[model samples]
Target: MKGFTLIELLVVVLIIGILSSVALPQYQKAVKKTRLMRLAPLIKAMADAEEAYYLANGQYTPFSSELDISWPDGTLAGAATDDGYLRFSDGTVVDLLSGSSYLTGSASAYVMGKTKEGIYYIHYLDHSSSPGVRSCKGDESLCKSFGGEAFNGGWKIP
Candidate 1:
């Protein structure tokens, strides 16, 4: 008599469950977006460094140290593997694509970052062509949710 009946308790539990189910996905999305946003600044810095290096040397270098930029903490500057990918301590993998003759430019470079959730972000810079091209490759809905435009079978980020 003092407490709620079984039916009333069950209803309360059901409502709580429903609310949680609705909120969980949104929380996860926010987490994912935050993770992606964290890498944006790093990508921009890398692009700037690559551009400066290209102007000085007339070519891009795959080595982060050669660019003369101050890398962020937890960045493994010496941890570049044979495939030219750098792994961060926070499970982010970055690959600097440089010195490729495929694009028409004095030098073309792209800094790609792959988050722990398997979302790939690419910041492409071409000195003679497009100065900045930001794109994301992953779940279409997720990409679009974070303000990505559909471009050439990929999501172009603003």
Candidate 2:
């Protein structure tokens, strides 16, 4: 006799469901931000390895062979194609930057591209390629943030 009516119970359940739907996307975005941040350190590590290889060889070595040294400790949760020159994870392939010293100087070399399930980025290898000044031409805001003779930010790559 004290129990709530079926209509009241259903109304409560519907409210809860509505609340969850609104909150879910925010939670998902937070998760993505955290994941993206974790990748920051990994990116730095890769960059360090590339620099080490540069110091030892005078320039970037072959992208394939040099990748071993480029990411000397790379064991991230991704599939490394010939070391870490190319990293494929969660359906995304992140290619390290290189030049003729790497993959015949193809666009495949000289830049790193990150394509997430919903986002993408094209990273350049030098300041010369910064936005209006480089080969990247999709997102202007992202391009401007990317810089350095040795790096570019993780862009939304195609």
Top-lDDT candidate index: 1
Give the Å shift of residue 100 in candidate 2: 7.2
Report the CA-based lDDT of candidate 2 relative to the real structure. 0.47
What lDDT tens digits, residue by residue, belong to model 1 across residues 21-135?
A: 9999989988887777788998888778877777777767756657656666657645546465678887888777643522336444577788889888777776634458887
Q: Report the C-alpha lDDT of model 2 over 1-158, residue by residue, as the tens digit.
A: 89999999999999999999999976876665444444444444554565456556655545544544433355335445554345544544455644342432234334443535434333333222342122333334433344433234333322
Which residue pairs in model 2 clash with each other? 98-110, 120-155, 120-156, 120-157, 121-155, 121-156, 121-157
Looking at model 2, report the run of 10 residues with the lowest lDDT sum: 126-135
Task: List candidate 2 stretches off by more than 4 Å.
Answer: 67-79, 83-92, 98-118, 121-158
Give lDDT: candidate 2, residue 135.
31
Question: What clash count goes with each model?
Answer: 0, 7
> RMSD of each candidate?
2.8, 6.6
Worst 10 residues of 1 by lDDT: 99-108
